[model samples]
Target chain A: MATKKTIAIIGASGNMGSAIAKSLANAPYRILLFGKEEAKLKSLFKEIKNTNKKADAEIIGCAADASWEADIIIAAVPFAAEKDIAEKIRQVATGKIVISISNPLNETYTGLVTSSDTSSAEELQKLLPHSKVIKAFNTTFAGDFSQPVINGKTIDAFIAGNDEEALETVSDVVRSAGFNPIKAGALAVSRTLENMQSLLIQLSIKNNYNQVAGWKILHN
Target chain B: MATGILLFQSITVILYYNNMYEVLFENVSKKIGLTKEEEQLLQTFFIPKKLRKKQYLLQEGDVSKYLAFVEKGMLRSYTVDEKGIEHIAEFAFEGWWMGDQFSFLTGEPSKYNIDALEDSELLLLTKQAEDQMLEKIPKMERFFRLLLQNHLIAIQGRLASSLSNTAEEKYNQLVQACPTIPQRVPQHMLASYLGITPETLSRLRKNISLRK
Candidate 1:
């Protein structure tokens, strides 16, 4: 077998980060789990190991170190921390796939924090010009990772990236995590995906779905 | 080293036992014949799972992901009322299939709970897998249609019985259909399935024995 691809998850202690890590535990990938809180990272690592004894994962102290050794870097931190993390890992993340999974929701949770002109993913792309920035998983809730099939329908993960190869790679990762990957077009499409998630969040709150709702496009 | 080898051998045996699909193949063969190659291909579509007694296969408020065919042991589907009284919907024995069909078909949250009544082995197939299977093997399409027809007939009969039959008549009909069920299931569960109290079932059984 060929050598497994390495994926570094920044902010691996956070809800989305840990959920993604757990989802990919059984997949054929080497995982580098990093977060600001050392203790949380340690517990997350232990949790992953407990679930899958053969998980190829380890806790790393910093994002840059993890990104340097990784083929794919997932920025699982909040939208507010995206620029700070981009600056931290800019040098090493060049020529690698950097996935932006943050949604820039406003304080009221009724709107986007970012201006209507550009998305968090598009901004991240501008910040790390050399890295292939792909937007994905923002439309999905963290709880859906463990059981992506809601009502017998697999949840759809909308992916957007300028690089076709990067988009395909991210689609494969999303599929491996038990979601149906829908290529929602180029990096600019991330704006629409983010807005879609904001609407879904609002609806879930108003309707009492308890954050278990997800998207599934039905077609002939 | 000897103990380790014994442990490894036991695990291997368990794995081999779990992978056995003979029961599923036999059930399918009764409906339609398949070539050895087709059987091998068909095996890929199903996922084999084991549930200990009392383990839930499907729960209320969750979507039914797979339709399960019982290979061994028994399972029961039930719903709890607002007062916490369980109303048994149906029971699935060996060679029978069970699922929340409404939830599975419509992609909605189920109002039913399916759980193993005994330590059970089942072959589970998802809707996508079923569609692909029918596409690959046209013969399976007939098998499934026949299965659905039979299921509908049974359901209609059950509905009629629930509405019109006496408790005694219902118990007798159930026994006539599944002779082994009375022995396998608890009295209260059988009563619940008949939509009657346990005391009524007990009295009915006693009266029937006296008549015999």
Candidate 2:
């Protein structure tokens, strides 16, 4: 049998982190979970194992020993902690495909903390230049990750990255997790994607979108 | 002659009502599986209304009484700035819903003014009526929720465009998303919708044509 690919989800206790873990519970990959809170990571690991009885993939949880050898690293940390987490993982995550879902929304969320010209993904890329960074899942709510279909249509996950190879790998991961991955463009396009999340958040608060909604691209 | 006019009006009203029901039934059924009986039940809450061209469906100080759904023609919702310049927020056409949600929910004075761009047909449901319908038919709640979700997604896209895109890019995106918008809406209103001056829109159009 071929060796299973490893996907390391950092900050695995948070809402987004846990939701991604749930979506990948039965996937054909070794799920490596990392978090500051050991107890929470252990609990999530147990839940993933219980949910997927036919699970052949190794599910490992760690606090100090972060898995650097994983094929993919998901930065599921909050926006404030994005820099800190990236700095911590920079050396270990060198040359690996890193997926960022951070939205640099201001405290009020009426605006973005990061400049509209550059994105949170770009900022992270500057911090860790060696790692191939891709922006995705920022526009999707945790509620969307719960189910593949909303109103009988598959939710579209828009992704942007500079590296063609890295984006293709992430697209495969997105498909494995039951979403239609849409290649939006290069890494610079993350500005639009991140801004979209801020806008979606504001609309959700003002109009009661309630996080159950996501975007879908329909082709003619 | 007066009697004949009345008879014609009655038949037109009947046909309009049937069209309204058909649009609503299909829109709701596509989202949530609805039976014919449930669609009939859903039809009772809507009250049909007509607006002549330039007629105001809602004004700034009026507490919005109904969530208006468009069955025919176009309506524009906008707000006037302190300088009396209008900023168009949204345009609703066939099978679209438009209302001042804040005013409808809170009974407060609205900041928006909605006016018919053409002779328009509308179906209105008050908050109480909508609530009662949802209580009677729970599936309709899902339908409305999905509708709001779609609207939110579109609004988010517009917001993103405004924040990051240039005027020309915004115009291109708007046309790409709604191909008929530029054809149906007047250029001035299109400029307003894009948050640009009419002159800028004209220049952009000239530039685009020159490039072609």
Candidate 3:
């Protein structure tokens, strides 16, 4: 359903946002990215366009605050600004799918400090009741977005949300990015996926590695 | 006559304060600073429980009924991998709170289990009791919200630490927080909780003490 669709990513000038923008470059989608710093976002667009990809897709940068508009707002902001961005996205994305990729991590980025009940995705759901909120693309490391394959094979992309149709739409986007979409469960299940990132990051740090070669979650 | 009631109420408060000095509740008041009344109220609801090693406080697919505060001994909340290996999610000992937050909040089946890492005692509050306590003390909501907020901060800290700090640094921070936890818990469990292999932890310890 995300085929040739218009997509907007909030907090788009950051590492994860740019990685996502790069991955979607060749997909059948138009990427519109929003950032707090308009000039920085413009530069990000230039950098994205500078890349050579066969998809040759369009990447547009907009000067909208996260507290404002668009369809398919992928909030890749840091955890602190997640709820604030969600509140803002709720105001604009009426009946639109708001994709949340925010991961709540411990200071060490190793263990979880949040109790089971307190996940950013769950809080975003409560904060944005009107929008079709879905959690996806958060589990993958920033470096792994471009190279989704590990050991010469594709890796699983986990997605979950309350709205089934919204979830499927997001899954379609995951597939578009050339990754496997594994529907974990409802949005509450996202806490596990998000938490899994903590476990992975811990392993990465433990092994003295920082890139995708740092760790691998073998789904066999 | 009114003066007598004031004396009685004050006496009651004094009595409640007198009973508050055990291991689990100590830093809780210091860690989060629970009010005297709220502390007394929590004391009334937190049911005491004990678990032997290999016993679960809760199991997967079971609705978690209680949010437990660890009194003594270590507990591990974990999920079993497809290979049947347990991935330790959290480890609690002496004042740490352990429960599947997903199940604790939503009343749904939990994917993780909270098990006693050693012979452990917990002061737990059932879902019903927690609701009643919240109703009885509306401000208790603030207490729990603060607790959640603090936990979120810690989680964020760990995330940042993992990204920026070394394993030794993370381990050092843990040792600072609970100076005696490593000695109390099995090395393997501690390593798992630390997101490292037992061998790595052993090596790290060797590397540190050697430098010392």
Best by TM-score: 1
lDDT accuracy of residue B18 in candidate 3: 41
Displacement of residue A94 (Cα, Å) in model 3 is: 1.7
lDDT of 2 by residue, A82-104 (tens): 88887556544545678999988
Could you tell which candidate, 1 or 2, scores higher by lDDT? Answer: 1
Ranking of models by lDDT: 1, 2, 3
Model 1 chain A worst lDDT window (10 residues): A1-10
Per-residue lDDT of candidate 3, residues A1-220 (tens digit): 1113457777777888878877776676657777777777777677767775444333344323222223366877887787666544443444457788878786767666668876778887778665667888887777888788877878788888887767888998888776788888988898898888777777777886465732334656
What are the RMSDs of all candidates, in order? 16.4, 27.2, 24.9
Encode model 2's per-residue lDDT on B60-84: one tens digit a residue. Answer: 8777877989888889999999999
Shift of residue A156 alpha carbon in model 1, Å: 0.6
Least well predicted 10-residue stretch by lDDT in candidate 3 chain B: B13-22
- lDDT by residue (tens digit), candidate 3, B126-198: 6766887788877667768878998899889878887888788989988998898778778887787678899
TM-score, model 3 to reference: 0.47
Per-model tally of clashing residue pairs: 0, 0, 21
Candidates 1 onward: DockQ, in order? 0.01, 0.01, 0.01
Indicate whether candidate 1 or candidate 3 has the larger lDDT: 1
Model 2 chain A worst lDDT run, 10 consecutive residues: A56-65
